[model samples]
Target: MAEAEFARPIVTVDIVLLTLHEGRLCVALLERSAQPFLGVPALIGGYLHTDEDADAEAAVRRILKAKAGLEGIFFEQLGTFASARRDPRDWSVSIAYFALVPQGALKGAANPLELRPVEAAGELPFDHQEIVTAALARLRGKGAYSTIPARLLPEVFTMSELQAIYETVMGERLDQSAFRRKVNDLDLLEVVEGEKRQTERARRPTTLYRLKTPVAVFDRRI
Candidate 1:
């Protein structure tokens, strides 16, 4: 193997932070503060600090906090993107990750973070649109038959709210009765005592529940 072939590539961590906003699936984007694409909307990302970051996840966490003012959100490694022409600055590779959080959690800092509908976020820099598409596919695929959709809800929520989050991510409507039955069978949630809330459309207060555990598992029925 040639030494040149083994040369280290410029590595960066890019995050696709997703949330439910105004009844739509939204992705968080940060306007680039420096060049290659100055002032252009891009995924929250930065060069991985070799000495400072212990791993790619650590680098992602630091970048999210620094760029998006986000922390403690549900995130997972989506994939890796590498193309010689991906970055105009150099030959670069990016470790891509996706996170899900409730819109309420992002309230104060969303000013700097542009929350665009996933379908409408066009032409992001450095293969980012491709990255976002991958993340969306992962979310929708896992959402069916997994507890992944719970990450987009508040700690306490009614079954209707849960269904709404699922539908929003899946980009389709689910039969309410069937959805409730499936959720009950999964046993992923536990009812919260003395916690109930009613939406404007509800005739009565609905029972609230929270996840029994954070880890999501697949269910064959879904």
Candidate 2:
């Protein structure tokens, strides 16, 4: 006897490409070029290609490289959003991924992205707003105690700059001494010997540091 079949849902990956610009957390969006929502801004996403993609991650990498011209950027799976009503075309399943990148990286990409402050991304189509909210929650939750926040900075940055990024992600001020102590205790950074840079906060040369690992998690919050 033959088994009953279920309807296949539309599988895709949506990227929440976030960055800090002018001290504000922003997300990248693109104008829909096709029908149903043509000319309207939406999150960068694409349908999964079974013949070409090895998996969802491959699809995401392909989409980002194709649409945003981005490569070797850090991103993690935020969550899955599957529902019958999210898309007008069909039942949709979106494997959402999020990344925090430096502003300069966007500038260097061959295809520049349209960015909007997270709070102002504004009434996006398809369940994108929900996906964005989830991504932000994950970032804020992991950002408090890990080197994850440093992903927003350049390859190497001053301690002040790292603290500023943390404050930005956490949406509050952090004590300079305390923050420095926490960072040192985590041992997540390595000082760049003979390297110093001037920041807007001061004209004096400041110590530069780089993450020892891509990311690290602590049992406690900073």
lDDT of each: 0.86, 0.87
Give the TM-score (vs. native) of candidate 2.
0.94
Task: Show where candidate 1 strays beyond 4 Å.
Answer: 1-7, 108-111
Candidate 1 is scored at a TM of 0.93
Q: Residues 163-187, candidate 2: write the lDDT tens digits.
A: 8889888889988998888878878
lDDT of 1 by residue, 134-198 (tens): 99999888888688888988788888888888888888988999888887887778999987888
Task: Compare the candidates by TM-score and give the number of the best one.
Answer: 2
Deviation of model 1 at 164, angstroms: 0.5
**Lowest summed-lDDT stretch of 10 residues in model 2?**
104-113
Report how far residue 124 has shifted in candidate 1, in Å: 1.1
